[model samples]
Target: MARITMKFGGTSVGSPEAIAQVADIVKHTVDERHEVLVVCSAMSGVTNLLTEGALTAAAGNPTRYQAIATHLREKHSNAIRQLLPSDVERISIRDEVDSLIDEFETLCYGIYVLREASHRVMDKVTSLGERMAMPIISAALRHNGVSSTTISASYLIVTDDQFQNAGVLFDDTERRIRRELVPVLAQRIVPVVTGFLGATRDGVITTLGRGGSDYSAAILGAYVDSDEVWIWTDVDGVMTTDPRVAPDAQVLPVLSYGEVAEMAYFGAKVLHPKTVQPLVDRNIPIRVKNTFNPSFDGTLLTHEEHVTPSTVKAVTAIRDVSMITVAGRGMVGVPGIAARTFAAVAKQNANVLMISQSSSEQSICFIVPEEKSASVVESVQDELAHEYGRQDIQRTWADDDVEIVTVVGAGMRATPGVAARVFGALKEASVNVLAIAHGASDYSLSIVVRAADTERAVQSIHRLVVLNGISPNVHAPEPIKNAVS
Candidate 1:
């Protein structure tokens, strides 16, 4: 029997009803004779409440934070009362929930007094969500006649003290899981741990960033060397495009690691970017399943065992981006010009998304999220205005809504004309292609398109590259004139 690790997201265990649904899924897995380990996120919207509490406390009042904490405590206790049968189980679950709330209040009090929320303290506060949710889930599973134990992830998943975005120490984490967690699995008992929160060497709470629950599952799956890691989420699986944006978007049955990585980086909402690394390193396949539809065969992500399909595997895009241009004749052969421009952006904490440099070294262009566009432009102007002069180093910021559309497929590398086919389809659809970028891997082709045409662009690319077997050399019609300007 294959030993597997299954993780359910917040929506999967949002309430007593949802918890029962998850318990049913677990029962099926256990009945199949596979040793199972399950990890669960907080109830739907619980983490957000905890975050709001911290923000309120940091803004100078602890009253609202304390009230929110109490509300959260009541929410979990209510779930336990509805789900657990034995009085002992109910008390044990309540006490664990209370301890988590106590920790949260302690952190809020610190934030109120200091009038600040450091990443370390934020991690601690955010962790309470999972800590409060997992015990209720474990108790529910036990009441359902499945032997389950609540294991604290902070005790097993050890990382360096990087606070909000702590990096995992794999050797230490793997050792702890093998030595400490394996014993429980050996007894055929399911270990239900809280996802998204880990601890530093000194036992201080640290998080793995916003979508850390996905990362938590990947880490545990790798440590145990499980046969497969199943990520239970709200979506059906990884789709060819965002269903909301492109109604024609279809779900892909299989994907390679490279394809999945590209889709995640370019804004596929199925899984976090970091969640695939451990699976890739350990050669474990990952399945993205829907919590609501447990019977469907969801998408499977595996290493390249065979060539990717010739058609485009998926289309991904993200909106609300601003493109910045740094161009000047003086930039030609100017050493440290690129370095200075990037350093300036970094100083303002603006994330550089896509960067393209001209072969002549005369211009460097990058895209940043719309919110940081102004700050980034000012930082660049201040840093480069003197060296190349205002005119010499021309700076222009385009507020024209832009969307990044990427076509992902491992088959593109072997197929000649994949890029030509994608561009050809977009051209046929009259979708204006701005800057285009492709790497040596040939797994993806990214293009800048107008936000208005984002959905059409993805649908067109999906049809041309994925559904219809069109050749890259297929001739595309002439470009459409810009009427919006």
Candidate 2:
């Protein structure tokens, strides 16, 4: 039997009924005699609650955190009552969970006094979700007649000092995982590990950022050299596009490491973008399966991506984005303008998503999350204060009304006219393309369009390129009378 690392997402363990399903799945897997390490996400929405508590307390509101503490108590205690049958077990676990929440209140009090939440403190606050999740999952596993124990991932994975988004030290992390978790496996006890969390060498706890539970599973699976990392989530698998957008969107049975990475980066659900690199480096496989529909084969991610004749695998979108552009004749052939412009955005800690530059070197345009657009514009202006004073950069503006749609496939690299087909579809739909970026990797083609046109643009692209079912309501359109360059 192969060693398997199974990760259950938040929705899979969101409540008593969900935890029961997870327990049943684990018992069946262990009954088959495979060495198993289970990774668990915080029960759905707990991390958000923890984050809200921290921010509200920093805004000087104790009443909010106190009420939040009580609400948490109700949610978990109600869960304990339903999951653990024996009275003694229920009392024991309830006390432990309450103590964890009490510590949450204490941490919030500290933040309230200081009126500031540092990244370190925010990580600490957010990590409580996973901390509270592990032991309860351990209890639920035992309730299902499986031998299981909770292990903190921080003890197993070591990373650099970056608090909110720490980078793992792979060599050291590998050594630690081997030293600590192997013996537990030898004992035939399933180790249910916390996801979305890690620590520095100094033992200060850190988080791997949002959706990091997937990354945690990837790291552990690679270090332990498991046969595959199974991500159990809500959906059947990765779809042609989000089902809400095009109800006809079908599940893709297979994808390549490169293809899935692009989809995740461009906002597909069920996998994190950072989760792909570690598995790709080791040639390990990732399988996305539905927790509700356990029998479906789901999507398999490996090195060899499938390419249809259409040369388009999927169309996906990232919304709530803005484009910032800097333009001037004086910027032509300029040396450091681009570098200085982005260095300023970096100082603001803004994430730049896509970038385009004219061949004339006269303008630089990029995308950022819409919420960060105002501050990013301010910072870039400040960075170019001298250029503004002298008029070298004649115009700088942010348009916070855009969304990015990306078409993904490995087949695109060898196929000609793919770009023409994509633009041709969008033109037929009358969706204006604000900016365009073709990824250096050749796996994706991204374009920015007005936010209002997002769903229509995605639908239009999905209809033209995807091979299976023809989307309804897709039609040939009148030719464009005028075009903008």
Candidate 3:
């Protein structure tokens, strides 16, 4: 029997009906004799509501979140009533929900009284979603005849005190999980663990940033040394590209670790960007499966190499980004210009996404999030104030009218002319390339195009690379002449 850690995203456990279906899936896994460890995200839209409520409270209106709290109370109670089989279990879960709702209310009131939401306070506020989700899921599983227990990740995964974006302390976390969770799994009682939120060594609640639930599952899966980790989400699997951009986009049945990383970095939303980090060293495969349609075989992501038919697998785009260009004649032979420019960006805590430098070393351009462009430009200008005064650098500005389109495939490394094919497709589609950056790893080819041309660029590239299966050119030497002789 294999040990599998199955993680259900928000949509998988969005309601009573969805929870019932999730229970059925869990029961089937148990029937297959696999040791199951479950991780769950909050119901759909719960965390967002929670965050909004906290902000409302911080804005000096505690009464607004009261309605939200009441709505959540009713929502959870309705799910318990509809899905739970036992009357006693229903009553018990209702009481649990009541206590959780009360706690949520108390926290919001505190936020209102304080009139400020610190990072730590907001982390605590947002974590209530997953905290409420696990217990309800556990109760639903029990009603369906599966013995289950709700576990908090805070007790299992220890992290540093980074507040909203805490980093997991793996050594202590692994030891604690083995000490705590292995025994629970040994008894065949499925442990339904909360996702997203963990605690520091000092026992303060901290979140793992956005998409932390998927990161939670990966962290737990690595510690438990599961053979495979299955992430159940709404989509079928990782597609060639967004179907909205390319209507005929198809799901990729298999992907390598490198390919998925590139896809995720380039805006593929199927998996969390950090989901592969923990599993990479352990060699555990992460399967992206759809909860609604379980019969279909979803994509399997692994470190193992597979025979690939296409030179490029997918074209993805990140929209609403700004490209910052810093140019001047003074930058032509400057030694520390690049370093100093990036240093300023780092000082502002802004992330530099993609960077390109002219071959003549006259100027440099890079991409940052649209919202961060102002701060990035400010930092660069300040760092180069002397250069500006000396007329060494011309100007530094951001263009918010651009988006990034990336072509990702490991096969591209070995295939010649892939770049030409990509450029040719974009040219044929009449998409103007603004800035291009290709890394040394050959993992991806990233180009900046007008935001208006994003969908067209993506569609054209997908058609040429994925649908048409552009192959590398191979030349058979003059050996055929000898055979003819």
Candidate 4:
């Protein structure tokens, strides 16, 4: 029998109908003689509501949290009623759900009384969404005639004390899974596990960050030594680019681990940033499928990606980003400026997206989320205050009206002239490139451009590299007349 771990995002089980559909998927997997371990996120929007409640209570408005609690209670109550078949199951599930809700409410009340919500308390509060979801999903599976038990990942997956974004402790987690969960799976019982949550060794609640549900699934799949891990989300599979930005974007049938990693780093919505590491370590293939369209095989990711005729597999963009440039003629051979510049950014916890430096070492530039740019600039200026006063450092400034566009394909590593073709496409489309960075692996290249030119740039790149392949001795069609203007 095949041992497989299947994970569903919130949208997959957003409502009664959706939960019913998920139960059907589980039933079908079991009937095929596969050992299925399920991981699920909270119902759609539930976690946000829980987070808002915690923040509101922390803002000295505990009464507002009560209204949120009531709404959440009603939401889960309705889901349980729609999913469970008999009154016996309904009553049992209701009691468990209500108890968990009470725990959530109590946490909010504590935050209100203290007028503060630490990351630790927020972790405990936010985790209640997944805790509340597992019971309904487990009961739904049983109603479908599948013997399933709701298992708390907090008991199986062990992590460090990082409350809001904990890192999984692999050795301890693997050992705990073997001791606590293997026996249950061996009994032919499916374990419906909560996703996005784990606990410290001392049993303090913690999360793996947003979209950690996928990370949870990857972890469990590796622990079980499963043959494959499938992530069921709303989209059919990983797309060449976000369709919203490029209408011509197409779904990639397969990808390499590296290719998807680049996409994830540049803000692809398909997988969590940390989701692929565990499975990659175990050499397990991950399949991205759509719960809404189960008939499609979706996309598969493995070490050896499918070799496409095209050198570029996908073009994706990250919007609402700012580019920060640090330039100084006097610091051309500076030893500590780069280190000091990044140190300031690190203090703000800002993520650097794409980085480019002048060969002369006279200037350095990188992209970060627009929201964090102001703080990042302030910190850098403070760090280099003396240099600025002496005019040794020319300027450190941020441009908030920019985006990062990346083109990814494992084929690009082995192909020649891929970068030429990418730039040619952009040039033809009249999209001004502010900066460019080619990854060391050669699997991907990124360009920073004005936000207004993003869609045009992505569409043009997709049409040239993806659709036409830009074969040797052939060039993409000439740029549309003033298309980017």
Q: Note the Cα lDDT for every prediction shown.
A: 0.81, 0.85, 0.86, 0.86
lDDT of 2 at 380: 92
Q: Which is better, 1 or 3, measured by lDDT?
A: 3
Estimate the overall C-alpha local distance difference test score of candidate 2: 0.85
Q: In candidate 2, residue 353 scores what lDDT?
A: 90
Runs in model 1 lying further than 4 Å from the true structure: 305-310, 396-400, 469-485
How well is each residue in 1-485 modelled by candidate 1, as lDDT tens digits? Answer: 77788999999999888899888888777777777889889899998998898889999987999899878888888888889878997998899889989888988998999999888778888888888888888888888878999888999899899888889988888899898778888898989998998898888888888578989999988888888888898877788777776677766777778878778878888676688889899898888878888766677788853344455777888778888888888777778998998999999898876877789887787888888988888888888878655466665565547878888777676778888888888987899977777757557778888889888888888777776642334221211111001
lDDT by residue (232-326, candidate 2, tens digit) is: 89898889899899898887877888888889888887576788778888898788877887766778888876666667879999988889999
Query: Can you write out model 4's per-residue Cα lDDT over 1-485, one digit (the tens) per residue?
Result: 77888999999988988998889888887877778899999999999999999999989887878998899889989998888769998998999999988998899889998999999998998889889989899899999999899889999889999888898999999999888777777887999999999999999989998668999999998998888888988988898888887777666777789888888887788675578989998899888888988767778888886556677888888988899999989888768999999999999999998889999988899998899999999999999999899888989999998999988887676787888889999998999999999857667889999999988899999988777753343221221111111
Per-model C-alpha RMSD:
7.7, 7.7, 7.3, 6.6
Name the weakest run of 10 consecutive residues (lDDT summed) in model 3: 476-485
Sequence-dependent TM-score of model 4: 0.94
Clashes of 2: 0
The prediction achieving the highest TM-score against the true structure is 3
Write down the worst ten-residue block by lDDT for model 4.
476-485
Q: Clashes in candidate 3: how many?
A: 1
